[model samples]
Target: MSTGLGRGAGRRFGSGWISGVLAVTCGALGYGGVLCLLFPSWLTTPSARALYPLELVRFLIYVMLVLGFGLGALSVVLRRRKVLGFTGIALATAGTLLGGSSAEIGTLGGTTAVGLDWFLLNLFILALLFVPLERVIPRLPEQAIFRPGWTTDLMHFAMSHLLVQVTVVLTMLPAGVLFRWATQPWLQDAVAAQPLALQFLEIVLVADFTQYWVHRAFHRVPWLWRLHAIHHSSETMDWLAGSRLHLLDIVVTRGLSFVPLYVLGFAPPAVYAYLVFVSFLAVFIHANVRFDLGPLDWLLATPRFHHWHHAANPVDKNFAVHLPWIDRLFGTAYLPAGRWPEVYGISGSPVPQGYWRQLAWPFLR
Candidate 1:
């Protein structure tokens, strides 16, 4: 019976219809768990409590993020049933935001810390889930929008976000140690007395500028490109594809961007708010949804705008993340009048076969 089951599995592996049904079913179950189990507990938690409410809300948010990502993975694997995968993602995302807001998990110290932990936990879970899925699914067709090979992309995204969380935690150590060593009485008092809006703006400007340079460096440098290249190697751009970044690249880039915000005496409140806003945009820009931001694209980075940066041709453009003014100032902005790239990914380099190989290849190459 075991041998027969194994043979049956082998036969079913090659059938797109069978795999598509399985993918949609898995996504439905996973997403249903979040809506039915996690959302209510989080929403009903008391807002007056300090840690409990924050913790509950954070957990729910993480569950939603994980579910949305899982649905995205299933979408690619079960290409024939694209609508089911997309609907699952939409439902999970709505549930996550609703649950998070319902708990009133404001960007305070306790809530901020809990949110970071939630992000990291979700990444770990997603990475573990995708490893076996990659082995089971066959490679997708060249021109196909949903690639069965997307398990690698999901793993990359998970690892990158996890690394960013680690970097943020590490930043606290230096901030604490430096405060202990220097003991700046006046600066400490000033920071404590600073207005939240002013402090928030200061943090935003400093972080934006720091990230601007870090993003530019990724394009300029060679060794760094090896790791960063994973993000651009996706033949089909989707929500999961956005997660396909090298862990090392994430650590360095996010660390550099985060450290300045810490050192600049930005209020912790401001940092928390800024991180949430930026994190949402990062995913939004990488998402595969077809929405054109006509005039708004010039003011801020959009999917259509950022997608050009990942294009194989016209390599020298769109390096800035939030503000395009920096790119325009540096003469690196490359968006043409009402046009889009036909192809994306590394033009000549061999695409990595799997997540583990992609992770190791940066060092080995």
Candidate 2:
């Protein structure tokens, strides 16, 4: 099952692709800078301050601008990628002119946190780390780095990252309103009194148990299936493929998961730790690399575990996203000895191509 477009065949690194990638990178940085400059209070992440001071982030942005220009110059010198070079320079120049990387936050107070800062930082870091990993140790060696529908998936990634505030607001909206009445201080305190490791373990168990049923519903229920099917429509599974989720799907599933955590009243640190772990694990399970964790595959969901969920032949199996045991308990588990799906995607996908159309699809009926 080798697609000639695999990593071996993708090394040509077409000039057009190079230019397009560079252009997007430069544009995102410039766009992020403008957002920070104009709405600094609303476009920064709260976690960023704990990770690094504002001054350091600003300094790094400046360094990225310098590198952007240098790359642009190298592109032009090579003559093969002049368009990428020039466009990158132009965007980088615009960003510099607008004080995009400037540390000064005049009168904005820089308080209301957004996802732009997190988005850019994560974008750079994830690409730097994962792209090479996928290429070098690909599960499907024949799978290309730039597989079909990559652009659509990329848009999904950008939207989810850039609209972090909106996601948080919508997901937590139910928690804010319902938890106010449902929360039992005693229950919360009891749960929080457990050891840190126990708290973390319990959080995973509770969250994934709820998510397991919610995830299954997305496949069993017709309307919800319409939204979730979009997630499973990717013909090529990779890190970016996990990002191709419908916004409504994200809100509903994530919102559902939040209910238990809030009602149970897990400590703030435990809750935050769970969120961070889920974020990384989500990408890990959907990654293109081959990592069959021998015995752990039965315990934790791996790429193969998730790939089976997305398999066209047996679409309704393996609904558990993190823990494999949930499926085992519910009788939906379908790992057949030692086998991987020959192909991945929806069986008869009617989903449209672009992001907007797919988003509007669920309500069309």
Candidate 3:
């Protein structure tokens, strides 16, 4: 199958597609942001909400509501395809009528709600960062922003993020219980006592080592491949495509990776810094950008390094996420010197398209 959008992925770029995209993205996410503010205790992640500046968030929502409506109007006037324009306008109008940024906050509750806050913030921030980069230095210039399977990948991103609380709980439950006995206070104190920079490096190294094996196992094991095939099913690669993973894949791999970090007990700040860094790195590797990192590509993971991992021809290789050297050490690295893969996705045993279909796929097959 062609990796291109094929037909009816949406209108051409020169048309109002760009404006419509910005309008709908801003409107929908802004609406979610306002709901997060209004129901901080119920709609937000406690750990994440504490980090956000309420006033700044409120201001951004107000600005986005106006921007969405204005851009939507511009699109409506400029193009015949009024669907995107109309959708943006409706979302913005509804958000404004629902008190815009100043939505009322009632009594707070202890119960954890859906992570609307995480979803909106991550989607907004990552889209803003990667979209422009991809357009500016696209690996495949003809690769449109909205590819054939984009909406499906987008739904995967949305659901994975929206259920952050549940995923986090599940990830931590196994790691914490299985490795609880391994937390040596003396060792934790020593680990924490190390310089913050050193601690951060150690965390990445430890986590990467664990995930490297877990990642390889997914590719090697037959039953596991059934679940992992959904990820490889994407015929295209992009920042968004990385989000197209089986929910169980996320939990198991990340949960196992967390074991080392939790047991060693790195300092919270260092750990938090690692979390921020890893999140960006994960998306960066999957991005559809042409970034020639030169020698650093060998020392660290890069888009080329990762894109090879998803190559259609190279069934199982380049298993490490952060460190390419890990793959080199294990003789599983397949990054052909200075060459990009001709195609992506698996060869046989095709995984079906669409979010719900892919979700139910592993079991049925």
Residue-wise C-alpha lDDT for candidate 3, range 50-150, written one tens digit per residue: 77887898899998898889989877876676888888899999898888988886457797668888888899899989998998998988887788899
Candidate 2 lDDT at 237 equals: 90
Q: Write the per-residue lDDT of candidate 2 for residues 1-365, one digit (tens) a residue.
A: 23235432222454334544565475557556655655656877665535757676676667667756776765666544356677777777777777767736644564565577777777777776778888888888877767888889988988888788788889998888877898888988998888877888888998899899899888889999999988988889998899999998999999998899889888888888988889888988888988888877879999889889989897689988889988999898888766889889976667888788878888897
TM-score of each: 0.62, 0.88, 0.95
Better of 1 and 2 by TM-score: 2
Q: Model 2's lDDT to the true fold?
A: 0.78
Evaluated at residue 281, the lDDT of candidate 1 is 64
Winner on lDDT (1 vs 2): 2
Best by lDDT: 3
Q: In TM-score terms, which candidate is top?
A: 3
- Please report how far candidate 1 places residue 104 from its true position, in Å: 24
The whole-model lDDT of each prediction reads 0.59, 0.78, 0.87
Off by over 4 Å in 2: 1-27, 34-38, 45-52, 109-114
